[model samples]
Target: MLDQLIENATVVDGTGAPAYAADVGIRDGRIAALVRRAPGAPADRAPDRAPDRAPGDAPRDRARTYVDGTGLVLAPGFVDPHTHYDAQLFWDPYATPSMQHGVTTVAGGNCGFTLAPLHPERPGDADYTRRMMARVEGMSLVALEEGAPWSWHSFGDYLDALEGRTAVNAGFMVGHCALRRYVMGPDAIGGRPGADQLDAMLRLFHEAMEAGAWGLSTTQSGTHADGDGQPVASRHAGPEELLALSRAVGEHQGTQIEAIVAGCLDRFSDDEIDLLVRMSAAAGRPLNWNVLTIDAAVPERVPRQLAPSERARQAGGRVVALTMPILTPMNMSLGTFCALNLIPGWGDVLGLPVPERIARLRDADVRAQLLRRAGSEEAGVFRRLAHFDRYVIGDTYAPANEGLTGRVVRDIAAERGMEPFACLVDICANDDLRTVLWPMPSDNDPASWELRRETWQHEDVLLGGSDAGAHLDRMCGAPYTTRFLGDCLRRRKLVGLEQAVRMLTDDPARLLGLRERGRIAEGWHADLVLFDPERIDAGSAVLVHDLPGDSPRLDSRAEGVVGVWVNGVRTVREDALTGAVPGTVLRSGRDTETVGTR
Candidate 1:
């Protein structure tokens, strides 16, 4: 008898093929059989009209459990290739909100941030790791300190801690920052490692690979900084050092590379382009960067950003770019260290204590300097927030800001007879700089959406970069899969549902070399999602104090997700987790295949 049978559903199959009516059976955590309906048959009649059934097959009534998937779309579970769920999985084993959106598998430890391989003799290394994560990833410091025990010292031990304890299949890459700090200690930042230190790093990288790390993830993005306001460890490494680590990846099976160069947030320089090609070629594996933002207003940005991928291909290597189809809305505050601090010279004034920061903001010279830096060419991606007038006030704490919530800074400034920048500073100052600011993205024009649809079909691009686990308080990108699907179905209609599912599932799975987990073929793992095609979406973001130590985070619930299963165990029902913990801790060479570079 089948363990479970889902009947009368439209199966998209995660292959970009046309959807068809079918009944699927699961047994022993694998797809046991598929009973496909004849062409043009109605889904409700699929079971009775199923064709090509094998002899001695058990009837639908013989299944131990049955799911009525009437009028719903059944597809392979979504795979998120870029996330920071490393610490969240320790306390919230379900990887909440993600599984609620049909994400059955997640790859974490991106952008050179991981939580393992601590220095054997230095106990303070753990504290440094926590603070760094808090600073760069937007994770809550209180949650990081109280969420999980910092007992493990090696990558293997860290992986072991999560084994059999999660509700979603999770894999992680070894981060360059942790690897550097482990070997070079306090000298890990802003210097070339000596010969002996280099050798130690290579050996540690090998050990991590052996212990099931997905691959190597590093960063050279100028924006990343530790709690001490120093550049991240990976930013200090020269190209030779990076290439040496890339060479180490070539020796491992089922390993790839993930990196974030400075060009990831802007246009690529010729040297950065060549360096990416060399790294991919050195590793003999594909290298995928974090994000590729598309805006039709900037017509040259897409081609310029994708030029490196073409260059890498010509050089006998592969480079893929991750792009989000939906614009994830994020909230920022003046009191915290955020992208605002990355605005070139603005960091010096913004990094001061609340009293000093407010005092500086009140100074005319300081405001001019900050404004000038934000509008300059050096701002890069952070320039998007330069339009102080467009920011909508979110939460306010001072009595002087009454009736100002939900108002734009420009309108308020006009009413108060003040410049928009001065008005913004005044509002935040009234709240002691704790006012929440929601800057509206200017790239939501129709042309931009059209360009995004075209770019979604690009050969060198894939759909991901959710950043779900990090930036918990400011943003919640975990629901992009459902949100994009909803837009495609009901709003945008730019991309077909079949193709979108394929982008969210098979594309990233193939790029990451996940083994038999991205499709609904017979004998493949039965990770699946069933949802209403008419109403699926991610709801609005809301702040919730659910993290450890009662820290707050932005969260959203799904609209039409009905059921989700990981490895044949139902983990979510009706947009809520079912407390099932049957997910596998995916490891390189065991749960994946070696996807070659060329």
Candidate 2:
């Protein structure tokens, strides 16, 4: 008997195929049958035999549970290729908001940040790692401290801790920062590893892979800093070290590479491009970077950003770029560390106490120096945030900001007869640097959307980079799957629903070498989503103090997601979690196949 069945639904199948009416059956946590229904057939009518089954094999009554999928679209559950749900999974096993939006599987520990492989000799390492995550990833420190018990000491132990505790299939990449700290201790910050230390690191990497790590993730981006304001351990490694580590990936099965170099946040230099090519070539695995932001204002950047992928391919390697279909909305605060801190010379000023920071903001010379540095070439992608005039005031706690909420800084500045930047500073000053600022992106033009569609169709580009579990308070990227689907169905319509579903499902799954997943076929894992095409969307993000220690985060609920399933068990019904934990812990070479470089 079938475990569950959905009758008379429009099945897209996650293959970029045309939708068809079908009755899909699930049994033993796998897709048992897909009985096709005649057009306009009633839900109660018997269906034709499933393609793979004999006549009369799949009776409608055989299903133990029946779900009416009328007026809904059923597709393979979405796979999030990039996320940081490492810590959040320990507390919120369902990986909330993401699972709510139809994501059944998530790839975590991206950008070289993982929570395990801690050194038993160094007790403070866990604390340091937690603080680094809190600082670099915008995770609430209170939540990190009070949420998961830092008990696991190895990559395998961490995976074991989460094995059956989740409602979605979770996979993790062994992170370089943690590995470096585990092997080199405090000296990992700026010192190069000796021969024995390097060999030990390689051995540990092999151990992690054998223990079910998905791959290796590392970062060399300038923006990533430890809790102490020093560069993360991975940043200090030379190119030779990076290449050596990358080469070790080829020795493991079903493993790939994810990294964030200087080019990820900015433009790639010739040397950076060469290094990326070499890393992928040596590993014989596809390398994917975090994000590739498209802006019609800077049309030239599209080709420049994608150049490495082409170069890598030419060098017998594969490099894919991850881009978001919808612009992720983010709120920034001057009182905390954020993209504002990435501005080359503004960190020292912004890092000061609230009173001191406000005093410096009030100083003309200090403000001039800060603005100059922000506008300089070194500012890179963060330069976009320097346009203080475009910032829309969000939350304000001061009486002076009573009427400023929802107003743009430029308009307010003009009304007050002051410069926009100075006006922004004064507004935050009025709130004692606690004002919430939303910098409206200038690249949401039609041209940019068109370019994004073109990029989505590019062979080397994949639709992802949600960064869901990180940046909890300032941004909510977990709901991007629903939001993008809604946009494709109703709003911009730059891509059709079939292609969009394919992008969100099969594309990333194939990239990560996930086997027998990301599609709705007989014998495949029954990870699925049913949604109302007309109403599906990510609702507005709202602040909620739901994390451990009552820490706040921005969360959004899905609008039209009717049901979500993992391993044939329904985890969400009517846009709400059902408290079912039926997910698998996906491991390398077991849950995945080794994707070739070619």
Candidate 3:
């Protein structure tokens, strides 16, 4: 008997091992036994057929729950290493999109944006945190204006606020933005920290590390901007400040690091790559460069970028470029807050009155500027947003325009003999700036996809970039685990099942230094997911209005994520929450020490 028993599961083991049938026994929030394998057999490994178990080591405690997993595959729950749920956690502790798709762990405090130990008073005391979050996370100012109960600002205090949370386990990283604001104040506005300000900021980073922040994350990219279209605090800092801040990570057990450099479209300039190398050298820790991927529709671009990433890593600069899946759903908008437009100086176009915006779009001069910006590879502007010839899939404000759903704006503009921008603005204004823009890239080509698969298989590249808990409106990358396992591993055979499981499981766990997690050995944390590897498929991306601000998020459901557990407590039962809250704030490296089978 046991507190719980998962019998006959094809255990993927999360160790890059071939799948094999075994019974997983759990009790008191830990893996108690491995249901002994056949005698003279090679431990947990088994051929196509199953292995026999040794004499029963069942506990006197009878199973409180039991499930037959005869036809299902079981693996360690996913550890989503990249996400911006710092703001969302204040409201939705479950971290929806990621957790719903079997993510049992998340890393927040990305891009140096986190709410924490403030020297100031409460919520209103540090409006900067709220404002920065509003700009970076696309969080509605009104929501933070009303929702978050901002009490403290110390890194440890922030953790106290987030501890014992109810969704999946989470880890916190010290953000560069918070550091700048805490010390440099508004001086951080232009990027460079003055001499004294730089020293103070560095000291705070070290203090945060000692207080148990997992690592440091910052962005050097211009894409990260404040509401006024200025670079976020850390984005403008020179290479020296970045390297000093990165050094803080090395002090506390050599913590992990994450960074976002500007320019998603072009390869890093020599100076940028040199900067990354210096930061890595200073920190003496591995760094996860924000992202590394090309437009899936055009396969050549990724190779161009990956070449530099590989060069950096090979140069003893431990850096890994997280690659997004082929279908990085495009969400375009002409709203006042469309963050993408900030790049080409077109951000001004968004905040204008609807009539003014429409007039400008139709202006010959404005159209020329937009055209020039759209055609430049350096801009990385998704042309689909400016090209109004797209059709509306759905809308609430205007019924007459709602029928335009599924029709391309190009076709409509051609029929009416109107310019793309004119048609776009008319529809937008007519619909109260509520139009869903979808960029359906040519289906990920099999040959190209296979090449991408090779990247996932690399010892360095972990499978991720779901961008869950952020970008609520534009993309829904949260449920990518199922697709990686189902479509890429099982369906296409691009990577072996064992290798795929390792990518989603062990690799990230190791990278994040969660010692007791992402492995299925006896006495490890019993965090697990059970599914049908053969039948696993990602559901179609659909818009769902679930955020506190009626902010819609693209949610792609998993077809076969049947059950998930955290610390042996069932969190997702039959693909829905059991209403049980067993998660906690896991400070990496520290978590294994604080809460282990010892």
Candidate 4:
């Protein structure tokens, strides 16, 4: 007898194969059978044509559970390859909104940030690690302090903590920053690791790999900083240290490395491209990087960024770029840390104490210097934030600014007979630094959308970089999986449902070497999503207080994710959670096989 049977589904199958009508049978947590309609049969006959069931006898079938998958598209569950769910998983096992959107598997500890390898002898070590995550990954400090159990110190212990608690399959990579901190202690932040320290980090990396870590992840991006605003440890690592650590990844089977380079947000120098190539070459594995955002304002940017992947490939190393399939709108303010800090001189003023920062913003010379720097190319990708006309005022603190909410900065500036920058600073200062600003996202333009479609078609690019659990208050990326499918099926239609599902499922599974979980084959794990093709979308974003410590984060509800099953147990039904935790902690070498260039 089958555990479950889904009848009348248009099976996309997550293989980039043509869609077909089928009745899928599940038994013992695997796809037991896929009973397809005979060739040239009418589509309407799929539901009534179960091979073993007789006519007019639906209830007599041996299947214990039957799902009327009529008018639904069933495919393998999404695999999110780039996320920062390391902290969130400890508190929310479902990794919500992601799980809600049919993502049955997630790869966490990205961009060189993870909470593990804490120094047992050092008090406040966990606190320091959590604070780093809070700052660098945009997790709420209160949530980290109140929600997570900080008892575990080793990477394996952390994975053990999540074993049975998660509702979605989870995997993690040993983080470069965590490894450095474990080896170098308090000196990890700014001090370059000596030979002995580097060797210790390599040993720790090996142990973490042995303990089921997927691989190693690190960052060379300037944007990452710790709680005290110092560069994260990975930023201080020299090329030699990074290559040595990457070499450790090849020591284990079924592993892949993740990195966030300066090229993620800016142009990569030849030296930087060489470094990525050498790192991947040393690892004998693919080096997947975070966040390849397309910008219409700069038409050449995407090509320029992708050239590194080409160079890496030509140099006999594999590299893949991760691009989000949705626009990335950010809510930022002067009082908080944000993409604005990536501006050349903005952090100096913005990072100050409230009183001093307010005073400096009102200073003529300082304001001029900051604006001049922001308008320059040295501001890199963040220069767009200076275009105040595109910014909408959201929240206000002072009574005088009550009417300013929902107004554009340029409009306010024009009415006040001042420049946009001056007007913005005045409004924030008067509001006691509580004013909110919504900037036009970089990837919202039509040209970028077309470019995204084209990029998805590229061999070296993968659909990912959702950053699902990070940047809690600033942005919501967890819904990207469904939102992208919505775009494919309901809006743009540039990508077929079959290809989109393949990109989200089998493509990532193949790249990461996760075994038996990305397809709907007879023996594969039954991680599946059933969704209405006409109505699959992540709705408009809203602020929600669903986190621990009453902290707020952005979230969205899925419109058409009807059923999500992990290991044959329905974790989500009717777009809601069933509280069933059937997820596995996917371990490299144990649950995965060695992956190489296809």
lDDT of 1 by residue, 342-446 (tens): 788888888889999999999988888889889888888788889999999999999999989999999999999998999999999999998999999989999
* Superior by TM-score: candidate 2 or candidate 3: 2
Give the Å shift of residue 550 in candidate 1: 0.5
lDDT of 4 by residue, 432-478 (tens): 78788888664676777787788788888998988999998888888
> For model 2, what is the alpha-carbon lDDT of residue 412?
95
Residue 474 in model 4: lDDT:
89
Over 4 Å off in model 3, which ranges?
Answer: 36-62, 121-125, 296-300, 307-315, 381-392, 417-422, 489-493, 549-551, 592-598
Worst 10 residues of 2 by lDDT: 49-58
> lDDT for every model?
0.90, 0.90, 0.71, 0.85
Better of 2 and 4 by lDDT: 2
| Root-mean-square deviation of candidate 4 | 2.6
lDDT of 2 by residue, 333-444 (tens): 8898878888888889999989889999999899888888887788888888888899999999999899889999999999999988999999999999999999999888
The candidate that wins on TM-score is 2
lDDT of 3 by residue, 1-598 (tens): 4677776678889898777777788988888877633433332222332223322333334455666676788888889888877767777777776776788888888766777546563344378777767777767676676656676678888887877765688888888877887776677787577788888887787778777788888887777777555778788788778877777676677377788887443567667777776676677777776566644565665665565456656565566677765466666666546644754757667668877876776678887787677656646635434444443444436866856877777777888898766676667767667676654454457766766866665655667777787777667778878777776655667777787778888888887778689988889999899987777767877878776667666777777888989888888865677766788888655673211100
Off by over 4 Å in 1: 39-61
Q: Give the distance in Å from residue 447's predicted Cα in candidate 3 to where it truly belongs.
A: 4.5
Per-residue error (Å), model 4, residue 94: 0.8
**lDDT measured at residue 516 in model 3 versus the true structure, 0 to 100:** 85
